[model samples]
Target: MQPSGTPSRRVSAFDIALALGGLLFIFLSAQNAGPAIAALRADGVQGTFTAQRLDCVEHPGHEQCSWVGDFRSDDAAVVREGIGFYGSERSTFTPGATSPAFDTGRLGHVYGPGGSNEWVIIAALLLVGLALTLRPLLRLRRPPRTPAPPPVPEHLP
Candidate 1:
């Protein structure tokens, strides 16, 4: 607790660090959110992804997989090579097979026709960041209390 008569709580290095970290998280969320939202809405260049191969990585208990492919827009205006199809699974596509996809200018990956839940994670990050940033400042807004008066002594024995 702060001593009486102090105007406000002193800000600490930890508080500053927390706020900075929160800002970093907020910045990261903002940076990725646009592309993620666009991809989730399929609001970009409509294209077809031709699967060239399946790239799989084995973890301790499971395997993560994606289809590496080339994308060509329906209008033939946009074409991307060596891009991975987002949310692809092991059996999602066969070699040389094509699937409808959307390119929202996110590096290295294109979204599929079925939308993704990526925005949920980004929203959560943003909320947590806001909370962290505000928690330290909230203490400073509270008014300080005056010291209480001493109790009177007994008058009679």
Candidate 2:
């Protein structure tokens, strides 16, 4: 390297941390992405969820609700207990009511006849993770900037 004025790009601990955090996000999102997509596609055990109870959590402005129940496959071959019916609302079901559902083997929750839009959030997380992971590496690839020519000195008469 004959050039002495070029600024060097060094990978700092912060960059490593960012990359590691990004990998964690990517891993967590990927773990759920497949099941979420499958649930959206209704590609899993077709079943009916029997509402045993409605669980609600009150928030500042509104309440969130989920129907906790049992899911039984149409053929009666598969049955799961105490699983949540995803996207169930207060008016959607009452005690002892049943709705068609799909179980993509995701624990504790199943999809209803109408698939959910969870994949969108998962995709966003993946994009954010990818950006975080690549940002620093990309910075390192750019040509080093030449140091601004030493600030022009004022000439005195």
| Candidate No. with top lDDT | 2
For 1-157, candidate 1 gives per-residue lDDT tens digits of 4465455568788988999989988998999999889977879899899999999999999999999999999999999999999999989999999989989999999989986778999999999898889878886777666567798887995
Write the residue-wise lDDT of candidate 2 on 12-85 in tens digits. Answer: 89988998888988998999999989977889999899999999999999999989999999999999999999
Error in Å for residue 68 of model 2: 0.7
Every model's Cα RMSD, please?
A: 3.3, 2.2
Poorest lDDT segment (10 consecutive residues) of candidate 1: 1-10
Name the runs in model 2 displaced over 4 angstroms. Answer: 1-3, 151-157
Which runs in model 1 stand beyond 4 Å of their true positions?
Answer: 1-8, 143-157
lDDT for model 2 comes to: 0.90
Model 2 RMSD vs true structure:
2.2
TM-scores for every candidate against the unseen true structure: 0.85, 0.90
| Candidate 2 TM-score versus the reference | 0.90
The models' CA-based lDDT, in order, is 0.89, 0.90
